[model samples]
Target: MKKDNKCVDINVSANVGECAYSRGSTPIADEGDAVIRVPVELAVLNIRTNLAAKIKFPEPVLEIKDIKKRVQIVQCKLLLPGVAAGTDPFVEGSYHLFIKGYVRKNIQYASPCYNSGVCVNSEMRSLTTDVPFECVVEIAEDDFDRTPQLPFQNARAEFDFFRQQDLGHGYPEKDHFLSSDLSQFHQDSSQFYNQMPYCELISSRITEWDEALDRKPFHNSANWQEGTFETISEKMFLQFTVKVLQNQQVRVTAL
Candidate 1:
């Protein structure tokens, strides 16, 4: 391999944590034959969107339970070569690290009301059924154990370049969801009722009763009198699956 003088050497290990996972590192050597003991630091990875794939939401429907949240933690090991013993205990040779793992979420919901009152009620509800979605990180020898390098002085510059060159491309600017968008959809009940039949007034009354009985939001409640009905269609459920797989692949390949 073409040696880059700027490269730094270090040792790394992977660990999973709540909300965020970390890869710990310890420096075994440094440039100039200096033995350096670098403190262990966590490697933080982010979940991101896929630029090449399009996420499709099932037609607007009131009744269906979508995946509220899905999170995953994965670990991979790397090995470094060319070590000089008796050097400063802190100094470490360089090593290259590659991470691989799967992250996915499955959202599932029944189709919305096509007919006003014939088969299902009009009150909008969150689908109770879960959509099964999964993302896979194909495990291979390449995922584990790799070379090492010296610590780059300009870590951010190196990281930006590495992300651009090695990781899969980022999502398009338009496709990237803003914080407001996420918060708007996450944990908000108003959005659900708006999609269902009948005005918010009727939906609200029905939801009140449903909450009293189940202590949970009604996913498919048609009206206060109609009770809860299945609103999510099979097609919508499949869409969630596709989203999970596609997103996971995009994240892994990019990393």
Candidate 2:
């Protein structure tokens, strides 16, 4: 090492061609811990479900121009509120996942004109509404990336005492005996907690149909005028896949 920065070069003869490869044992380090704590993937679920709804219009809608729809997922969960922790409940030999969400619908339509029957004279109106929904799907014997991990608890230990009294006259001749306590016995049962399972949404798909069942043309009006609809019915076929997850410990190893 030099304090003052300076460059020095040494002259030597070297070969420029490629060197032959050599075989040797790969180096391996001793592991300090056997397992690592991390979020692990549990199972993948492909769910298919449908929902139907009938909605009423705010005002008189003469004709429908356009409608735009989008899905907004509110929550995805694997655990229910009343279910016990660290336990998975089965219904009909299957696990159930509950999904909650809403669909944002934007309706662009023309309102009927009382004084004029012509569609061009009618006023165009826009309505935005959210249709909420909830559904449950059953999952049984599903495929997993690996064996799903179960909840773990620590080893519990308790201490007890025995009744001890020394008999000086009896102990001088022979060994003294002690008796165990028999009045009360207790073993603590609430020494550990569980890591609950969770859910992650992968993707969602929807096929929807919106129809105006009561749409009718104005009285004594030509075909150019728009029809009115006071009520609308919608059918949505939703499809999505989710991943159930939990915290797990995996062993560290090298191939």
By TM-score, who's the top model here? 2
Task: Identify the leading candidate in terms of lDDT.
Answer: 2
- TM-score of every prediction relative to native: 0.25, 0.59
| 1-255: candidate 2 lDDT, tens digit per residue | 658663543234444677888774211122444556667776788877777888788878877888888777787766423333344322223445677888788889877556454433668888898888888765564455534433344444555678865667745645555876666564655433555767777887889888877877667556545567788899989777788886655556644
lDDT of 1 by residue, 66-116 (tens): 454332224333332322322322223332333332324354544444545
- In model 2, the worst 10-residue window by lDDT is 24-33
Q: Looking at candidate 2, what is the lDDT of residue 2?
A: 54
User: Which residue runs does candidate 1 get wrong by more than 4 Å?
Assistant: 1-39, 42-64, 82-84, 88-94, 111-255
Summing lDDT over every window of 10 consecutive residues in candidate 1, give the lowest-scoring window: 199-208
TM-score for candidate 1:
0.25
- List the pairs of residues colliding in candidate 2: 62-227
